[model samples]
Target: MPLRPVAALAAACTLALLGPSAAAAVALTPLPQSVRESEGSLALPGRFAIAWTGCREPMLERAAERFQRDLGRLTGVETFAAAGPRLEIACAAADPGALSLEAREAYRLQVTGEGVKLDADGPIGVLRGLATLRQLIETGPDGAAALPAVAIDDRPRFAWRGVTIDTARHFMSIETLRRQIDAMEQVKLNVLHLHLSDNEAFRVESRRYPRLHEVAGHGQFYTQAQIRDLIAYAADRGVRVVPEFDVPGHARAMTLAYPELASNPAGAPAAGAQVLNPASEAAYRFVTRLFDEMAGLFPDAYFHIGGDEVGDDAWAGDPQVEALMKTEGLTTKAQVEAHFHRRIHQALTRRGKIVVGWEEIIDTGTLPRDIVVQAWRTSNATARATALGHRTIVSAGYYLDLLNTAQFHYGFDPLDTSAAGMSPADADAARKLHPLVGRFVTDGVVVQPMAPLTPEQEALVLGGEAPIWAELVTDEMLDNRLWPRAAALAERFWSPREVRDTGDMYARLAVQQDRLRRLGLQDQAARARMASRLAPGASEPLLVLLDLVGPVRNMAHDKRVPAAIAGKKIVQNLTAMADAAPVDSLAARAFLARAERAASGEAAARAAVRADFEVWNANHRRVVAIAQDHPAVREALPISADIAEMAAVGLLALDALETGKPLAPETAARAKVVLDRADAFEAASARPIFSFFGKRPPADLIIMVTPGVRRLVEAAGG
Candidate 1:
């Protein structure tokens, strides 16, 4: 089906459609492709029942139970099989158990004064329709729940709307994984790409090769029974779990467990030995057996063999690799990788798997055309692969662990082909908006212009994923890191290419986060717990500070921070200001809105912006008092001072703008110095050198409102 303007269906919608008795109108994420709302509401049945008209299928029946429970929870009314009002679900043609890229997920939901009728071609479609139905619910003036009168026709824009859950770095509980899976289904996300094994650890228990988990897991890994349950859970929610077991490199933990598989002759589980000896027959036997066994556990056809970061340190002068290179006519590092990947690819494909690897898989030679390459580092990853008839998943700009805000990631369209989502002018505007912060989220990208592909090659792009690498994240804060932002990216994958309204996306995103929380995700609760832990008797002030500040962006919060600064390897300290701050600063966003309006010469907006600065200017003293008293969180003191000083600077700049005068050069210089220091701190954090890394890094957080301050001072034209 040719795609329509994704949000255009609701482009003409108005609050009038709610018949003047609705609580805010319906705002759905991954907005349906088609919508027509009218002036009426369907009061939810006080007594509800689900009328499943589909074939006798367990998936549909289970979905009905879930919906009925949601109904009672939402409406405060009990529902039973014998009911007064019915939610009629009709899917006569659905293959209830089928879930894949080819599965039919299109559904039409019509909610009128009479009742709700959900029609779909299959069970997956019914689930999707049910999700939309849940979103359409609103509170009536009578204080009762109601469904706004509307009709929606919806289907995901991409077959692979995915999220990557990294359990290898920090083992997430099965409960945590299931919570994300539930949230995924609620937003129409269809794939859960599990980063199961990495250099840090192997997260999945291995019964066949006991040592892989026993020795390497360090007492934490999911058992096979748990994996099976997870797979079944994800399947019921229409999510496919694709497991990634990195090979050739990112193999420190793997080699540590099986010394015989190490690339280094001495079997040292160090940096240089962080790769399996691909030339060794033992390596091949281990890989073939382990992968084939894993293939049986994960029923999905796609399996990710992490073929990324195959560093020269691991292969440069290794004797086994060199001898194999000479004998196999592999002249370079890339060629040697090709030999290993080709063998691994053949091994998995023979066991009925479509081998998925990182963008570096291209180094593995021509190999089989059926291999799926995950485009992580660059757009060229997709461009080069699609040209060779290999399928690709674009993940270049969706690294959620970068601490980028939602709109920044949403801008990177997998199919835009030109500029990824922003033009030169847009990018310039974005960077200037937060010049003081130095590394505005958009600064680090070097956009690659994709060579135009034929229609056939374009189809090879199977959507994208938002990867939440667990380096700086763990089960405690994973929800806060991935959510709401992932919801925005989910729309990019599920909604149309034309749905580019960042403002609208943010508005709906707020609603989606609240909905997900109510549905049992703990992002906000976790953040609150960490904040309370930081300032025992004074969490309110710390919470406010967190809402205003953001965690350091990109790889700024990596292992080197502790290794060089704190003299440790990677520490999961949850009470620090860095851990408490969320990547998206709600206060910063609100302040920026008013600042934007004030910059555009609005009067009331100027007052509101000034008020925000005033609050921040005073709020810091409380936070400082709380932080200094707690040694574990004393790192927040400098950041607390900066927030107050910056807020004062903002007030000064606003006064100059209001009085129609230039800021004094001295004041502007001071503001610039502070902003420059903040930017420098972010830059230094991401580098790997001692001078930059160990230089008593200025606070662990980034000021999210630096852009407004910079804009005002620059606007004062000092």
Candidate 2:
């Protein structure tokens, strides 16, 4: 008989014998490519044990320790190392040490009646298998620790799945950074890109130039010792730490430390200084020395130069830059920028480093071909960079700071057709346009595009990153701002392209949120703490309000304060409704979507809608009571009242629909008026409040419940 026949017969026999056990298996996030369930389960003894062999690397030892700790926490049992029928972790080879194309980070995990067996080619793969095994642990009917019998073979689809944290905008503590790395490892995210310098601050200590951290860092920079420890910590968890020191532009902090290197030595601009003096040989020397020091600090091979947002006015008023431009026969500012990048690239290249920069650098075409271009702003930039023989990482759709829904990021893929909907002529024309020319032109300058990636260019795409720009994000809000959403993006990067089930992802994410919380990620707790601060004696009302609303999307909050006058006047506080909430209310959105479908006949969905309305209708009184005493809550009362009225109208419509009674015309009219009033309130509420000092918008409420309310009325009328 053929092997296929024998395999098929064995699979059928196994399934028939272990029907319930196979069916009761938990769904894994970043779903493994292949999984098989057999007849049986693994029960954890009073003392959980892990037996390891084959790899003597320090990272493997750390991984084993982590597994024991996490297993104990999750199962509430004492975990220890032992031999015999228990968890077995084996590596076929030594630790790869670094994450790269050749690193074997794939593993096979099998949990059976005998025990749990995890096998991998390297220690990194063993670490990944441990994450999956932890996720597989569940409580049995007898309330004992148990795991479903299953065999899973899994690997990431992309090699460079990463997250970029901007510590320069707002400093993050090393403890917080390490905690984030722990969560990233649990999600199998392998890279931590630290943006260490920006206009606001230089976030790393430099012994070579003390002032870079002493004066410019405002006492918030990380020491070299802390960074080395962090790198070691991340490595043990199989995460690569890539440090970014932005240059030329976003150089206010650097220039603050040494004014001689600035394009305009008059001091930083209101928009926080634009670029360094390309004409100054001293500036080049400073950058080179700084990068050399950074290279020593960050052992990772790739370094981000942050070559984005260079403005023409940056060098317009600089005499030295102008003189050099004239002497060098440089016709435009773009050429000057190109020269700046070329020199910086040469410096890094001499240090055996591969330079990485934003997509703006791609337009120069003068940098080394080995450079990695991060495409942000434009959709087609990824393809454009790849077509030019440069590797690309996409961040345009993965901008976590934009407050976009996780579904929005999930729908974006690196391999999407770059020119799918464009006309054939336009598509060809787009290809001919300068890669620097973005989709939208402002003041005759090409910015960034809004296009996608073509299939042919997909091979050059390494992966993508979710960047958390910290302009609006404080350290307290970091957890809520990143997690759960970042987890979805992680799946997009790790899982196969066909695993695009948003519903399933959400279901899995719910479990992930709890796991992350248990592992000490503080998103929920942080939000609750903020709510308690805002409400003092009573936080339930505030919590209830936050659960139904989220922050405004698309940088609307930032735009409210005009940039020209913003000038360090923009204050980030918990007073704004968005401050405590995330961009997307997944639970509310999913509930609304379900309610719309269930309005036709589903009893449970209808009840859910009714219960939501009742809660909101009662929440208004609670909000009003709390608002009188809390200024923060008072600022949101108008929006709260509108929500209450909207809910009241929805309850009336729901009643009419359930009773099969035609809604009174006046009642329907009142409902429409309430909806209109709510919309107007939201529009007016978004306007910035101009005061004696400056202009700033009060935190606007994200009206998540209104859409469901509208659906209820529409269903009643129909």
Which candidate ranks first by lDDT, i.e. highest? Answer: 1
Taken over the whole model, the C-alpha lDDT of each candidate is 0.77, 0.75
Per-residue lDDT, model 1, residue 488, is 88
lDDT of 2: 0.75
- Per-residue lDDT over 455-572 for candidate 1, one digit per residue giving the tens place of the 0 to 100 score: 8878999989889988778899888888888888888998777888776676567667777887888987888898778778778887777787787666556655445444556655
In the range 1-718, model 2's lDDT, one tens digit per residue, is: 1222223323443333223343344645566666777767777754346677787577787777777778667756553233224778888888544565556789999888888889988878988898888788876666567787888888888988899999988888888898899999888989899999988899888988999999899999899999999999998888999999898899989888887777764444423455788998998988999999999889888999998887757788677877887898887888888889999999999998889999888765466789899977645677678888888987867888877678878988866634112233433443344332222223212233344545657778989899999988888888989988998888889887876766566656666667778888988888889888888988889888887777766455664344433454545554456788766676676566556755676777677777877888788899999887888788778667777888777778878888998678998898888676555534443321211122222455667666777777888882
- For candidate 2, the C-alpha RMSD (Å) to the true structure equals 6.2
Ten residues in a row with the worst lDDT in model 2?
687-696
Give stretches of model 1 more than 4 Å off. 1-23, 45-47, 72-85, 140-142, 265-272, 418-449, 559-574, 594-614, 645-697, 707-718
